[model samples]
Structure formats: structure tokens, C-alpha cells
Target: MDEQTITGSTASEIAASVRALHERGALRTGDALPPVRELAAQLGVNRNTAVAAYRLLAQAGVVTARGRAGTVVAGVTAVAQEGYAPDSVLRDIGTGNPDPRRIPDLSGALATAVGRPVLYGEPVIDPALEERALAWVSADLPGRPVRITVTNGAVDAVERLLAQALLRDDAVALEDPCFLASIHTVRLGGYRAVPVPVDAEGMTVDGLRAALESGVRAVICTPRAQNPTGATLSPARAAALRAVLAEHPYVLVIEDDHFSMLSQRPYETLIGPEHRRYALVRSVSKSLGPDMCLAVAATDPETADRLAMRLSPGTTWVSHILQRLVLAQLTDEAVLAEVAAAGRHYAERNAAFAARLTERGLPTQARDGLNLWVRLPVEAKVVADRLMRRGWLARTGDEFVLGERLSPSHHLRLTVHDLEDDDAARLIDDLVDAAR
Candidate 1:
């Protein structure tokens, strides 16, 4: 072979070719590639050469290795390349998602949001949405000063807040067994996550006091309807938490009120008036629809402006259309009524299942959320396996753990909705047997 042909045979050459394809939009992330053996044979190259190229690409974060599923491209905007393909066979039990049947339609409201698209560098946020959101926040936190800015979602809000307030390696207090996204967001953003213990009352005041003592700059909490465990912060617990936080006014508090519209529980914000700095991220995903991808970030004006600076012509802005649509849904009396009804329905159904477990001597506790946290007599992992064998899927407690090496409480986080009597009876029977 000549010099040009010899170069093509090198692994770096293959990698460079792949990189060029990606740059030209031919090789995109999330796209599946042929198996190494097959690809090598197709390219008339040695198997080792192809393996080395794939390895190099993976090291560069250009591709991902899906065990038993083969290699796939890993880059930005790879809708065509990766994931449990739009039509994959695996049953997804790991995704902690809501039932779409519950999310109300907003076709009519969306029609109002789509006006003439603004020109380049034009403000992406809707003025009408800002006005309505201001009114909404005023109702929630009367007499307390605040500012509102719309974001793509709760994750976006958290990311922006951390970006503005923290530098790499900064410590932030997060609930132990925290929402996976919250933990991941902090860790990925180069901030350290300090575990704050959680109990039935929600995050313990002791935990907050300790985290502050350790010099955490920020704290992220789910004031009500905590994820995974789904526990609401009791008013007494909130007061205690505020008492501890008041001592450290400089530590920014971020309360994610994710279940506001979907929970029948009373509203009690933990950020006391005296605690000068904090932000509240409220999203409609759980209450409305996941596709909405909209959240309202209410914070002090300085923090608001920092967030706005990130949103201004210098950075990406949330869609005015989505904001307007959310505003329309919020202002509509009928939609509000429907959402309230959905909230009650979720609560009632979930509570009913918990009651059934309680009646069976399992003694499940009733909390305010779309899911229930049930404590089994044995280890949760074993119980989850048994449930899976019986054609039911449930989340184990160990998955939500943080820094501390505490034994799991034999607890199962269950989502109860649209239950069939036979399946429900079978699951309860299996759980009873599993517990024994």
C-alpha cells in the first residue's frame, strides 16, 4: 500500500475521519453505529484497528458503549443516534415519569401564544407572561418582596442559580437520598454535594445547621412533595428549618416547589421574610404536562437580574410561546379547576393504595404527593425483585442514597395510578408474601 493508503489504515486516521463526519453533521450523537467486527469487515480493516478507533472515540466522549446494544454516537443534538430507540423493546421501569393521560391539553391556549415570531436579539420572554407571573407570585408570598423569571424547567433554574452563585468545588447542601437530577446537576456543574438528612418532617433542622457549619454556600430543598420519597415538610419542621437558616442569611436557599398545582396540600414557603436571599422554582411538568418544559424562578432582584443577564441577548432565553401558553393555562378558570381535580384524583388514588397496604398490616403512611413511600419488613431490593417477578415494577430505596453509608430502610417508593383491581390485588398479595 502507498503512504496515503497506509495512513488510512491507522486508528488516528479513522478517528479523524469520524470527527470530520461529526463536524459535517454526518456522524451525530445518539446514532447507532455498526458492530466493530462488522464495521471492520466492511472497511476491509483488521478487527483490532476498528476496536482501537471505537475506544479512542469513547475516550473522547464521541460515542457511548451500550452493553449488548452496541456502540452509538455521543454528541450534542443526536435525536437520530442514541437512547432506547423510539421503538426499543426494553420495558422502561426506571424512568420515574407521570402518566400522560393525566396532563391536560392546551391546544386552544397554545393558539394564543403563537403570534408573529420576534426578530433576532428580541426579548425571548413574553411580557404578558411576566405580568401574570408577578401577580401569581404576589398571591403566593403576600407582603414578601420577590422577582419572577421564566426558565425552561426546574433543572435549568437550578443550573443557572448554581452557575451564578458558585464556582467550581463550592459546597452546597442537598437532601440525602436527594432527587437524582439535583445531585447530578450539582456534581456535573463542579460543585460538591453535602448530604442533609431527611425525615417524615422533611429535611431536619439539625442537618441544615450542620451543613451551614461545614460552610456550604447554597442549599436546595423540596419544601413540599419531595421527590422519590414524596414527603412534605411539616409547618413545625419548616419553622425549625427557618430558625436554623436565619442565622446564616448569606447562604442562599433554593426551594423547589414542584407539586404546587398538583397537590392538595396547604402552601407554606420555608423562606422566612427575614432570610433575605432565596429562590423558588415552580414547574408545571408534574402538575400539567412534561412537554410544557416551563418553570417560574422567583428570587431577590439581584439574583433575578443575574438570571436575566444569563437570559438576555448574551445567552439563551426561554420561549415566549411556551411562557404565554403556561400563562394562559394558569389564568384559565376551567384549566385551574381541571388541574385541581387532577391533583385530588392523584392524591385519592395514591392514598387508596397506601390505605390498602395499611389495612394489610403493612402500615403505610399517607403523605401528600403523586406517589407513596411504603416500608416493607425485609430489604427493599429483595422486595423489588419479588415484585418484578410478579409482573410489577417498583423503585428501591438504595438508589436515592447520598454520602452516608446507612442501611436502606426496606422502603419502596411506589407510583399508584390507573390501577386494575386484579393487578392491584396481585401486587398487594405479592408484597405481603415478599414481606413475610
Candidate 2:
């Protein structure tokens, strides 16, 4: 048997050498590298240097470390489906984006951020933004000594939070019909995703218990306006989940409240007071706009420290200008009114579309969020194809499923909030015809 050797004096050099091997096709997926001590001896470096190199590789998604089995090249991560076709003339209702017209205008807010020139070594999070975010997130959080951090977006926050607490191959509990970005993040990080089936009232208690028993290190949940499914955690459901999580108080629990200000339902949390590791992430993407690219993460002090290590000075801090822009808009009375109206707009539009589908005997319900999760009698892919033929693009539920292969799904997630009444009716009629 031939042995694979990576040579470098330092951690960065060794990581770069291994990366080169991967890029050159010398190291394929699942191919194990030399043991840490052996690699250190072979490279003439200390053991800690080799370990640091491996850790850097794991964080970069280039390789994964399995406790006893050793580190190996990580698998290719799947990218989330976003945006639309440039050449297609179809009406794109598959894009999970908030209505642009409803997004608060930022021109005035940008002007207010020009008073001071922020330089290096300054605070990572904007002072005003941090104070406002602390108050907003603390109101719903149950724990004490709540610490707040800001990241570029909800996806960035979740990625960093998971990276700080978990190693590659560690099991993470996720909602079955998960968010696409979440699916991509977990897979790309070389982590195992344990599916916790989600129902109309949020994550099933039995599924959660099963996941906990399987020794999952972390659980990622969306408490309200769950993507694709549009399900909010009912009070009873939240309590049941909290009870189950109480048994495993140390498991890292992350709540992504992406629809924070835009959701019609009250915020329900899964973290209990005694739980040790937890983070609640709220982003302004839906309410303010995705382009703003900012989210506030309220977490336990220890978890905050771990996350801060990665977000230190020059590397990955969220821009102060963007943070200030968000704060300026958040404090404005007129902007608050617009955001409230936008929330109502999404709920009303989704509800109206669901009602239209129900009237046509399709029996669809848009519980919350910007999209409607419609069940079709046929497979979602087949229905999606038919809809495409009729000049419409809809996203199939299979795209959101996690695991080896996609399970049979007869659902289509359609973003119809921006559609006009006449257009929506036409799409509904077309959908009915296509499904039949």
C-alpha cells in the first residue's frame, strides 16, 4: 500500500499543502490522511501544530475528523438553489424572497450613518445596534446573562455557531423539511444531519427524543414561520420540545428566528433557563431586506466567547456602516410601521392564496411566512415540470429534504406574496390543471 504524506513546517503551510493535494485529485473524498502524530513526525513539526492544521482544515470544510477513525477528505457540499433563469420568460414563484416594494427604504438611513469614520480596533458590533438588538432579543429569551453578537446574516451566524461547538462527523438534529441554506451548511461542514420531522405545530416530540438519544451534539430549529412549511411552534409544542431538550441540557440548541419582526405569531423558544449552550438568531432580511445582510445573535456567555474568537478584529466582522443602517431604520417610527404593514401583507397574501387554492378543492393552507406549502396529489417534481410547461417555476419540497436520498414528496413550496390577484388566480388555475 502507498502512504500519503503532506509536508509543511507550519499549520497554515500544512493546510495549504493538503488543499493542494485535494485540488490536484490526489486526495479524494473519504481518503484518510496520516495520523496526527505520524504527520507531525513526518513533517518534523510538533504534535500541536499538526492538530492545529487539522482543525483549520475542518473549519475550512476541506477535511473532516472522525474521533477514532482519523481525519479524511470531506465530501462535496451541496449548494442551495437560488435566483432565477435569465433567458426564461416564466413567472418565477419559486424564489423565497420578500416583496421588494415592502422593504423599508434605506436611502435616508444611509445618510445618518455618515457622522463618524469607523476605523480598525473599534467595536465589532455597532453600539446603538447592540443595545437595540439586546433589548429586542432579550425580551423573548428565557436565559440570564444573555450576550449578543452580530454577523453578516442568519446563515453566517448559524455556520459560525455550529463551527464553534461541533467537529466534523458530529450529529446535528435538523427539521426534516429544512431550510436549503441550513441543509447546505450542515453538509458542507461534514456533519451528520439527524432529521427531526416537523409537523403543523413544529418539531415532533418523538423525533426530537430519538435524535437526542442518538447523541446528537446540536439541534438547529426555526421556532416561527419555518421555511418551506410555514409552520409555527404552538405553545403546547414548544413546551413539549423544551421538556424533551431538558433531558439533554448540554446539547447546543440554536433557534433561527429569520422572520422575527415579520412573523405574525408570538415568539416561542426551546431553550430553558438551565440549559447551558444555546443561541437565538434574529435577522432583518425579511423585514428590512436581504441586501442589508445583518443578524443579531443572542447566546450564552461561553458560546458568545467561542463565536467571538472566529469574528475577531480584521477577519469576519459585520460592517459598521451596514449595522448603523439597520439600527437607523429599526429606530425610525415610519420604518417600524412599514415593517408591521409588510408582515400583515405577507400573511394576508399567503392566506388569500391558500383560500383560493382551497376553493378550487386543492386544500392548501398558508399558516405563516411568505410562501405557501401546497400538497399535490402527484409527485412534486412531476407537478413542477407541468407548471413549468405552463410558464411558471415552482420549487419542489424534495429540494429541502436532508439525508442520503430524497423521500417521496407530493408538495410544492410556492412564493406567491408578490403576485397580483389576477396572476395568483391564474397560477392557481394552472396549478390545479397541472396537478390533475
Candidate 3:
């Protein structure tokens, strides 16, 4: 029998053929494809066409080019979003989840949401929820005629925002040690991620400029309490970033203020008032509870319209009940106080843990957020393994990396807010021993 012909005339066509083969199970994950020259000869196309096809596939997360090891199908898996480690003997401090005890109780708020049943063909956003969400977001947003759209969560809003603005293979500027959800979203959407190095003050201006120069079409930034690193944008840093972004007014800028009311730091924005395309997403997941699954997206009119196309009523609007629940809790004075107290509690606990580690000769900064980003004196994975042997689980910094994996990571992101005082101290001692 004759071998199946890899038929294509252009790069896109060739890439489509490979995708078809993969989907049909003829090409399995980790399987190596034919060399560019050999594939070019087989398909009767130029070698450059084959190269472009491979590059496209790599950008789409369909395959990875391993230099001397050759390109192979990428085994895409759900990134660790932090939850229980089933049947593990260790204490799991790596789960990036807010303590359930701190999450505001919704029982009282749910009772208040009993009203006229929501019907199809109604407005996509709840009227009361929209009013409250706007007031909450407008306090920090630059004065402009911004429109609001409600979504399931911050990640959902971000995904839809990027989908509306960017095309496949379009470059997007993302923080180097980015959020796991953001990384997964960009990769799964077939967009090219341009790494912008972030510091304690948030995304570096030089890095943003470089990414802009590379023709990035969009940028995803976390202005406060950046995940995995706890970096927040300072006023000076925001100004520098805005100055850089001003030149690229049309490029989509998405600011995810996931921590919102729960953040210990002030809200500093990267989107200049005159910027043409921008979205500021504020989610209640952290302050209320992840199960609440509600976020408000304030964006330019055009972007809002585009987003609406995907979230129109009768199609995919956020549940009116969920919206009302979030609004009810947010507006309640007692709930608000509880959320504020929870913020302080997280900050205090993280600071205490960091201080404990510092006294052990392992300096750490617990700046802001539920997790502490600790730098290790040795490789992070080695320390992680050692901690695992001592019945502890920790997340390595490498898992949050975007773009190139050029060097080994020597940092760990630990969620210690849920740990008791004694447990935290024990973990710190074990961490020190492991680091040494």
C-alpha cells in the first residue's frame, strides 16, 4: 500500500494537514514529524514553507521545537491551578486558593436575590449588578465613557477580551512570571506570547517597549497583586508603562485586577485615558469566593460591543442569579467588612511566614496576595523534592514561566495562609533544611 500523501501547497495548508493527522490519531503526542527538507521533498513544496508550517504549529501549542531533539507534538495538559492533591500524604501548601474560612458567607445574600425570575431576551447584565459594579470599578478607572460587561470570572473575561481583539499567531505581551490561567489561555488560543519581565513594581517599561516593537497586538497585565510573584505596579512604574503604551494606542491593553477589594496595595493603571482599546477586569472570586464566579469588565465601547457578541442574552450571559448574589454580598456593609478583614488577615499571615523564613537565613518578601513568592538559595525543584520527602507540597516558579525556559528557577510560590501557626513554623523549618 502507498503511504498517505501529505498534500499541501502553502504553510497554512500544510499545518492543517498535520492538525488533521493529529486529530485522527495518526500522529500521537510526542511523535516526531518528518524533517523540513524531507517533508518539503515529500509534499513537493519549498523548505521555507515547511519551516513556516512548523513555526505556526509551535505557536499554536500543537508542537514544540526542541532544537537538536527535533520538533514533536506538544502534550498539552491543564496547568496546576491549585487545589487538593488527591491521596497525598503531604500537607499541601502549594494550592493557590483563598482560605474557605475567610470567604464571605453568601447565605444571607442569596436570600435577598429572590426577585422576579430572569427571562430570555432581557439585558445581558443585571441592572443592579451593573450599577454597583460600575461604581466599584469607576472609582479607580480613568474618567472615560467606559461600558461594562459581566462574565463568569476574570479568566473568562480575559479569554473573551483577547479573542475579540487578536487573531491566531498575533503577538501578545505577557508578564514573564505570568498567571497560570493567562498562560494557558494564550497558548490554547494559538496566540504568540511575548515575555515582558516583571519586577516588584510590576511589568518593566523596557520589556513592554520591546514587546511593542515586536508588533504585539495585545497585552495582559496584572496591575496589583500579580500572581506567583505578588508584584504590584507602583505609581512611577504605571506612568512609565503608560508612556510606553501611549505610542501604541491601538494595541489592546487588558488589566486584570483579580484581587480588587482584597488587595493590600492601591490600584495603579497602565491604560492611559486616551488609549483606544483597553479592558479592566475586576473579579469577586478572591474577595467573595471562587465559587461566586463573577467579574465585571469595563472596556471601550467597541471592545464591549465585540465582547457582547459572544455574551449576548439567550447565548452565553452570566447567570442573573449569580450576578445578584455577587452584588448583594458586595453592597452589604458586613460582608464588605469581612472581605476587608480577610485581606488584612492574608497580609499578616504571609508577613509572619516570611519573617519566620527570614529568621532562618532564608529571606522572603510577602508583599501582597494569598501566596508568598520565596527565592531559594538552591534550585527550586530540588528544594521542592526535599520538602515533599518531609510531607510538604510546594509549587516551583518554573511552572509560571512564559516564553523561553532559558534557565533553571530558584524560587517557590507557597500558599501558607491556611496553615496554623505551628504548621507554618514547621513548614518553614523544613523549607530551610531543604534549601540548605
Candidate 4:
């Protein structure tokens, strides 16, 4: 082929040529594929088209680059995934805040989810999910100017939102000792974090004011069931925070209500319209089934549009099958009743556990949501370690700390009601010993 002739061909033609070369044993295993720029020059294709072709090959695991060795056929195989199981119970306590009652048997839906072969470029997400998600997210923010999008999970939504709103070295105000996932996401994105203090009623208004005054461009506040603490945003505090936020209307405000419908308390939206750039992320993992892995993020249209641009149905969209399954369960009156029942069941059980602990002289109190944030007389780590030695695993407050000073609260964060009766008894006994 003439050098001039080859350099002007389309990306598809170059790809075909590469495929033919590969099949003929001319390009064998461990052999370097042509450089993207060189291949584009030789095939007369645009550099971006060649890059795309290379990316497609990489995504298929057909080729991976080694430094200076060029892109070569990948020798390693991908690991197979084990089927998803509820993680709250392996020993059955102190993990996820899952309500066993919220999961409806989806035998029929599974058959439907499995019926068809999924084709490339076929919509990975169902249209019905978007429709129902619209109603679900906006239900609490009714008459407000916000748009909704369905993400694979709340973590995915949070990561993508942070990616779009903030860049490397940019600072965002986060709740100190924030949700573990939030801490991971911000640091992974290379953003500088400014931790604002939070208390029994959620993010402290004074701390937020100071952070804003320091010129943070983004703010992530959890309105209810603050992770690891279970604090909420009271109306008065929310109003006061809103007053402070009004001065910074242009800043992106993110309200992560991960424990939305499962909350024993009512939902109060702090991002009520008039704020220009705000997003509310609610996930079904805590309220319903964790394996469902779906979150609805409501935002001003501008942010939603940018997020939509970044998330492809193939790359990160929630499966249509899962979305349909969730909506079907959520819309069913019987299912809603069960979910409500689950909420009450969890609350009552957690209250009983708290009361029992109190009676045992450990002095723990139960609040809203699927977990209890317990106050301990001794260091939480010491208590948890003692419990582990007696055959229990639990999460300590230090795991949730986003602060630099290691302000370790003498507290243990535990999920309620996943324990067997004997296990619970043993736990209480060990806890009493640990406290004493």
C-alpha cells in the first residue's frame, strides 16, 4: 500500500486492516500494536478516531498498553464476579443498614430481566425508570425547579457530581467525619476538602458559614440520617443554613439523602428552589434492597445535563431490568406498606436494643434509620476490639472521620437487628464487659 494511500483511510478501514493482520498471525501475542498517532497517519484517519478505535479495543480487553512497549493483546483474563448477597449479615450485624422486609420476591421480574439477549448499543436503562424516578425524587421537592436522573448507585452519583463540579486542587465543604464513600470519592478525584463540623442536628450553620467564607465552591450536606452519627437537619437549623447559603447562590450544593424513604422521620428538602445549582441524591440501597444499587439524583437542569453527558448507559447507567424491577416494587401498594412496616420494625428493634444496652449500663440510645450511633464510656476502638475478640465485628467512628486531627469520638456505629438471639446476647454481655 502506498504511504499516501494508507494515511488517508478511515478509522474503520485501519481497524479492519489491524484485525486482518492479527488473524493472519502476522501480529502475534506480545507483539506491540501500532501507535494511535502513527496508525492515524498511516490510515489517513483523524487522530481522535484512531484513539477511539484503540479505546474500544482496550474496553474489550483485546489490547492494553505497556510503557514504551505499545498496545499489546492482554494476557490476563478478567475475574468472574460472585453473585450479589446482602452484606449486612455475614455474622449478621454492624454492616449495612438493610431492611429485610423491604425486599419483595421478584421471581417474575427476574424471569423478565433474563428473557432477552442484550445487544450492543441497545439501551442499557429502561425508559420507565426515568419516568418513575422523576416522580420519586421530585415528590418531596414538588413545585420546585429541579430535574432528576437515575444513577447506578448513590456513590456513582456522588462521584460523577463531584467530577463535574470540582477539579483537582479545588476545595469543597464536606461534613466532618462524613460518609466513608464521600471521603473516598473526594480524595480519589484529587480535590482538596474543607471539613465543616456537624452535630446532633446535622451540619453546623456556623461551621458551614466559615467554610463558605473560606471560598469553597461546592458543599455536600446530608439532610437526614447523617452517616456514622444519624443526625438530621432540623427545620430551624436548615433555615439558618439556607440563610447562609443564600449569600452563595452560585455554589453547587449537594444534599445526599442516602437514607431517604427508610427514615423514621419525615423528609425536609434544604435545596428547595431559588438555589441555582443544587442536587439531591437518594438511593434505594438503604430503603429497599442493597443489591438494587439505584439512586435518583435531582438537580438543576444545567448540572443534570453535564452529568448526563458524562455518564453513558453502557459505561455507568443502571440496568433497565433493575430499574423496572425496583419501580414495580415501589409502586405496588402492598410493597410500600411492607417498606413502611420494615421502617417501623427496624426502628422498634433498634429502640429495644438501645434500651437493653442502657439497662446493661452501656448507656446507648437509638435514633432514626437502620443503624444506631452509640455513645460509649470507653474508646470506641477499644469497645469494638473487645467485641471482636468475643466473636463480633463492628464499625468504629474513626472509620468515618474526615477530619485531620483524628477527633475520635468515643462511639461505635452499628447496624441494628441483624443478629441472631444468641449472638445478640453474647454481644451485649461482651459489650458490658468491655464497658466495665
Best by TM-score: 3
Among the numbered candidates, top lDDT falls to 3
Candidate 4, clashing residue pairs? Answer: 6-42, 7-42, 7-43, 7-44, 8-44, 9-43, 126-320
Across residues 1-436, which tens digit of lDDT does each residue of candidate 4 receive? 6322223265555556555666665666677777888887766778899876766555445567675778886655533111222443334346655756556666645654554555557655466666777777777776767777788788888888988887666788999767777876776676768999888888998999999999898998888888767788888888888888989888999889887777887766567457889898988887567778888898889998898787675666667667777877777787677777777877887888889999988777776777788888878888887776766667777767776654556878787566666767777787789866
lDDT score, candidate 3: 0.90
Instruction: Please give the range of 10 consecutive residues that has the lowest summed lDDT in model 4.
Output: 79-88
**Tens digit of per-residue lDDT, candidate 2, span 1-436:** 2334587899999999999889988899999989999999988999999998998898788998877999999997656575564577888888888999999888889898766877778888888888999989887874467999999999999999999999887999999899988987897787889999999999999999999999999999999999889999999999999999998988999999999898999988899878889999999988998888999999999999998888876568988888888999999999999999999999999998899889998999888888899998889899999999988988898888874454578999999989988898899899999989
Report the lDDT of model 1 for residue 71. 89
lDDT of 1 by residue, 34-110 (tens): 78888787678999998888777765668888878998888553221111225434332334556677777888798
Model 3 lDDT per residue over 251-338, tens place: 9999999997899999999989889999999998888888889899999999999998999786699988888888888889999999
Considering only N, C-alpha and C atoms within 3 Å, which residue pairs clash in candidate 1?
A: 30-81, 30-82, 31-81
Model 3 ranges off by over 4 Å: 23-26, 59-61, 75-78
Give the better candidate number (1 or 3) by lDDT: 3
How many residue pairs collide in each prediction? Answer: 3, 0, 0, 7
Q: Write the candidate numbers in order of decreasing lDDT.
A: 3, 2, 1, 4
lDDT (0 to 1) per candidate = 0.78, 0.89, 0.90, 0.75
In candidate 4, how many Å is residue 179 off?
1.1
Where is the poorest 10-residue window by lDDT in model 2? 77-86
Better of 3 and 4 by TM-score: 3
Clashing pairs for model 3 are none
**Candidate with better lDDT, 2 vs 4:** 2
User: Where is model 1 more than 4 Å wrong at Cα?
Assistant: 1-95
Best-first order by TM-score:
3, 2, 1, 4
